[model samples]
Target: MKLIRGLQNLQRAGIDSASGCVLTIGNFDGVHRGHQALLTRAVELAERYGVPATVLSFEPTPREYFSGERAPARVSNLCTKLLDLGSFGIGQVVLHRFGSAFAQLEATVFVRDVLASQLGVRAIVIGDDFRFGARRAGDLEMLRREGARLGFEVDGIASVCAEGLRCSSTALRDALAVPDLTHCEALLGRPYRLVGRVRGGLRLGRTLGMPTANVNLRRQPALRLGVYAVEARALNSDGTGGEFLPGVANLGVRPTLGLTRCLLETHLIDHSEDLYGRLLEVRFRQFLRPEQRFDDLSALSAQMQRDKSDAAAFFASKSTGPA
Candidate 1:
């Protein structure tokens, strides 16, 4: 998908920024069912107008900037979020860097300079609770006022819900915290997944006889630190290609190894190819066990063996517990 990084990038693109376009704006953190619904509307409008549907979002999302380490754990990183958007068939994306300077831009300037003049947005789709600009001044009312003079349309969508709960990034995070991914999968219409590039690690898993491919979790994580029954996929393209490989994984800091930061270490069952520098996706099928410190490497390695056995039994039986 095409990306317009910021205002300057959009201005320099040489294409008519004011050309007919339908747009949507938000963190879209998880790209959950709710976000998908809004994006679908924008795409439909774009198709009706013979224009492109563009997603306007921010990096270092507002919550991450304001709350620092206190921000909610991200449900999906940039790589995953972009992939999900692409699956919805968005034409392009605009990632605005969020910082102190960008934060203070006046509401009118944001509407006029960014949404109106720059994007030439023919229509915009967003949630009813949406707010934007300095000190949270922009809202549905602001969008309507600007649309009146800007020759564009504005739409505010209601939230989507499942099991009496609104589908939201926060709700997904809460579910992952419980490690109850069954409910998460229902709300998301798919498994809760973490995708990232595999990086070189200490090779400690090899020593334990369960070699792993290490990847970054991409935020101050909200998911519990534990072993999980999972499925891994090796992408053959820019994360769109799918090749599933069953696996078991541990997402946590190795307290026994004295590592302070959490990492995801996954061991693919029945396959071992060099994964360093490649992107892979892991889907949480179910929670297995909590992480704990062992008396020695031998003890930890033994526990890992049990985890492998448990995962094998799960897949072999093809049994999914109480619905």
Candidate 2:
């Protein structure tokens, strides 16, 4: 699983050795089941054509560029996307920057330069309604025309659905709006996850005998403010086996404590170790309850105990202990 951060970094390697590949292109925000179908088509095409399976996605995601603002709540971050793509047997990924220069490229320039010249794409796969390039004017027909001119082939995948509704990132985001992990999993093909660096917090959890590692969101989304039942993975300080921690997390401003900045505080059940300045990936398995403002520290402490008990029951049912 090679991670090519930028086009400049990729081109600096002299030449891309991958002569032929079955490639799919998209924003792939959540890499939802619909995106999976396209990737699956790419894999199948690669197997049949004896070429590497490749994915071409954009950084800063096109939406961020078009929106002229920070991205909305991301379903998966860069690290998580790389891992998820690797799990599907994708060998190569080209992450192009979606800056003004690239975004302004015409539909044909993108096809000729990125698809034909760099990737040496033997075949291209995309969703039926896929579009790209300057103001997102490129469509399936445009790709087909470019494929003919560039001597590559194009395949369009139809929508993938579950329980009647089409599986889509928008649908997944809506499901997450209500903190519905079960439905999110069905749409995402995995748990919805957030990746962040563990940073220092107020240590209020420490005072309550439930020390927590804080994960700060780089780009905050409108996630339902609440206490959540989560399955978290903490990286070992020595970089050995990653530890999985069943825990409860509070995602909100600590109203009772009168903190203004939003925080993610997770108290691991039966685990204690310093995680300051480490990277942690937290995967939300389910929503437990909404955050509440207690009248006093003692009231807050009492609620924390109940949250732990609920977390314990949730983990016990799964039969997987802390990793």
Candidate 3:
């Protein structure tokens, strides 16, 4: 999928303003089931109109811009969000940086100048409760009126529900906070995953004989701080094709080591290979234990061994099937 960095680059990217496209706009944080429903409709409309299916989203998301430290923990970062969008058949993504000036844009101006004029959007698919523009004045009704006047179509999708719970980023975050992988899977229509590039660490895990692939996390994640049974895969430079390997992972701030920065450290079971700089996707399978500060390195190392054993057992059970 083509990624257009901003509105200023849309014309440079050669998108024909006259031809137009079917579009959906949102943060699309987790790209959960609800988002999938909207995207599916957008794709359908794109096919019918013979236009590209495009997604208009924001970087740093609006909440992150306005709320700062108080913003909700992200379910997926930009890299993961884009990967999910492409997997769901998105043809192009227009990622805008959210800042003070953009936040103050009026509702009418946003519809006319941004959506209609800049994007050449032929049709829009968004949630019924979506709000936009200066002080959040834009609503479905306003969007419909603008679409009518501007000669475009607007489709408002009701909230999608899964297992009687609304499939939303908020609900997905709640499930992750509980470390309930099953419910999260239902909400996302897939396992909740953390994706990042393997980076060099202080080699503490190596000293402990665990030798982990450390993935730096930029945004605070909604996932509970804990050790988990997981499966990981190293993607190619193009972000495709990798064989998943069973592993144990810790998603935490490393309080025992007095480190405050959050990190994802994974150790592949019975496997050893260099993973530095490769993009890795870690999928949580089962929560094992909450992160804790052990009294000493000995205790921490012992716990790490037990965590690995538990993860190995979990994978074994899955391979063996129900007794």
Candidate 4:
């Protein structure tokens, strides 16, 4: 899959208005089951029309741009979102910057200039409740009307449901806040995972005999602050192909260490090699405990040992299967 960073780059890449594509536009946060349904339909339409299956996503997202620090926790970052899109067989991604100027664009102007002219969107797929444009003035009806005028097709997929619950990013976040890994898996059609590049930390884990690969989370995450039994893997350069290693991870602002920023610190139980700078994916298997402040390093170390043991047991249970 190819990634076009901006609207301007589309022309440079020869995917201008003439080279029409079937597109799905959204934040696509988590790329959960509902998003997958839309993507599946988009790909089908693209194949029918013999055009590229394209995704038009935004940076910072519309909510993040408008809400700033008050924006809802993000289910996935840009990198993970792109990875999910590619995995779904999307042929191209046009990542547009969401700022004041773009946010102020009128509904008709967005359809004409951005979708029709800039993207050459031959077919568009969106959720039934999808809305866009200045103050979200556009809806399914508006999009269909625009598509009719512009000589393109528009389709809206109904909301997908898991166990009668609507499978949506908001629902996924609520499940994660409950720290319900099982429910999250149901909603996502897989495990809830975080992917990030390993970065250097203060070596506190190392000093305590539990060295960790720290992944910095740039945005607020949908996951609850807690320790979890996790499976982690170092991804290849293309963000695929890696054997998962069982581990225990802490996802939180380290209150004990007086840290203010959130981080995902995973310690592989039995395998330890340098992981700095490598893209790592950590899948949460079970919630262990909520993050808490510890009195000292010794107390924290003891709890860490128990967390490792619990994670090992969880993996063992999985391997042994139901009795």
lDDT of all predictions: 0.84, 0.79, 0.91, 0.90
Candidate 1 runs further than 4 Å off: 14-16, 319-323
Point out the worst 10-residue segment of candidate 1 by lDDT. Answer: 11-20
- Indicate the residue-level lDDT of 227 in model 1: 93
Candidate 4 residues 99-138, lDDT tens each? 8999999999999998999988989999999999998999
Query: TM-scores, in order shown?
Result: 0.94, 0.85, 0.95, 0.95
RMSD of 2: 3.3
lDDT by residue (1-323, candidate 1, tens digit) is: 78778756876654355475799999888788999999899999999989889898888898888998888778877888888887898988888889998899888898888888888888999899989889999999888998988888998899999888999988988888897788888789888888888999999899888899998765646677899878887764445655677789999888998887778899988888889888888888878899899989999999999999988777777755311
Cα lDDT of model 3 by residue, 65-174, tens digit: 99998889998777888889988889999999998989999999999998999889999999999999999999999999999999999999999999999889999899
How high is the lDDT of residue 284 in model 2? 80
Order the numbered candidates by TM-score, best leading.
Answer: 4, 3, 1, 2
Query: Which candidate number would show the highest lDDT if scored against the true structure?
Result: 3
Better of 1 and 2 by lDDT: 1
- For candidate 4, the 10 contiguous residues with the lowest summed lDDT are 314-323
Q: Which ten residues in a row have the lowest lDDT in candidate 3?
A: 314-323
